[model samples]
Target: MNKINIVLADDELLFLQGLKAILGNEEHINILFDAKDGDHLIQQLRDAKTLPEIVVTDLKMPGLNGVEVTKIIHKEFPNIKVIALTSYFSKPFILNMISIGAVAYLAKNSTPALMIKTIEEVSKKGFHYDEQVMKYVHESITNPKDKKTKSTFDANYFTKREIEVLELICKQHTTADIGEKLFISPRTVEGHRNNLLLKTEAKNVAGLVIYALKNKMVSIENDSL
Candidate 1:
């Protein structure tokens, strides 16, 4: 079995050590390193011989901060996924992180089991949001105060196959699952997904889902997991 390589960043020593110890026990998880602050985290990423597949970072840090680090990772190391682990579980915080390219968001108080599940799901599916986060996402789209400039879907924007793939993705279907349901190869599903990302100007799968929701391409009732 292939291990999931990850790096962790947190300012609190006890919390950071505890998190490391918990994740370190999982046979499928390999901790590449741990950093005490956002600056250190970026430096570690820059100096590493092998980059981690995922980075789990705390939002409140001394320098750069989790949001800043996430933005940097999204821009500089696009392949490396980010999971925001912070005490702030407000809807705005969660929505902000998702929009900025975090593939998962977790409260610092999240259970070890949930944390493990999130890591595995994100490793396989590219993003993982709990029901609560999903609710926030839906509400963010519907709430008039939180609304952004509306995007209109052009009839020529995406092929029918791409729309099907996007709908499946918003419904939380994996690439293999989508391929099986759509009668296409997993690689083809991936190609469609890549095109969707490019056309929507989305940073990741999470961004794509948000774009679909914002554009009314998919409804929460239909896409809810």
Candidate 2:
């Protein structure tokens, strides 16, 4: 099995060490590096021989801070997913992180098991949101800002099969699961997913779900997972 390489960034030394100890115990998780501040984290990323698959970072850090680092990573290293591990658990914090390209958000008090599960899910699905985060996403979609322009859906914009694939995706189905349910190969599912991303101009799978919800193409009560 391929190990999930990860970087951890937090200003609290005790907390950072604790995280290292916990994640280091997992066989499939490789702790590539740890940073005490956001600036250090960015430097590590720049100088590293192998970049990590995920960055688990605390929101409030010394120097650059997590928000600034997340934005930089989003712009500079789009391939590396960021999981916000912060003390702030308010709706604004969650939504802001999501909008800034964090693939997952976790409270600092969250259980190690949940963190592990989140890391696994994000690695497999390209994103992961807990029930709380999902609720926030639905609420955000339902009550969009006045400045935000609503997206209109065109019936012919997406093929019937593509819609099927997209619906399954919004339900958080893995590629293999979507393939089995749709009677298609995993490669075919991936192809359709890529097409959906291209057509909608979404950066990732999470964006696809948001696009579907914003366009009223998928119902939150029925389609969200």
TM-score of each: 0.64, 0.65
Of candidate 1, the 10-residue stretch with the lowest lDDT total is 147-156
Task: Give me the runs in candidate 2 sitting further than 4 Å from their true place.
Answer: 146-225
Q: What is the C-alpha lDDT profile of model 2 across 31-74, one tens digit per residue?
A: 99999999999999999999999999998776777778888999
Collision count for each candidate, in order: 0, 0
Cα lDDT tens digits, model 1, 118-209, are: 99999999999999999988998888754331112223347899889999999999999999999999999999999888767799999999
Relative to the unseen true structure, what is the C-alpha lDDT of residue 122 in candidate 2, on a scale of 0 to 100?
A: 95
lDDT, candidates in the order shown: 0.87, 0.86
- Collision pairs in model 2: none
lDDT of 1 at 137: 84
lDDT of 1: 0.87
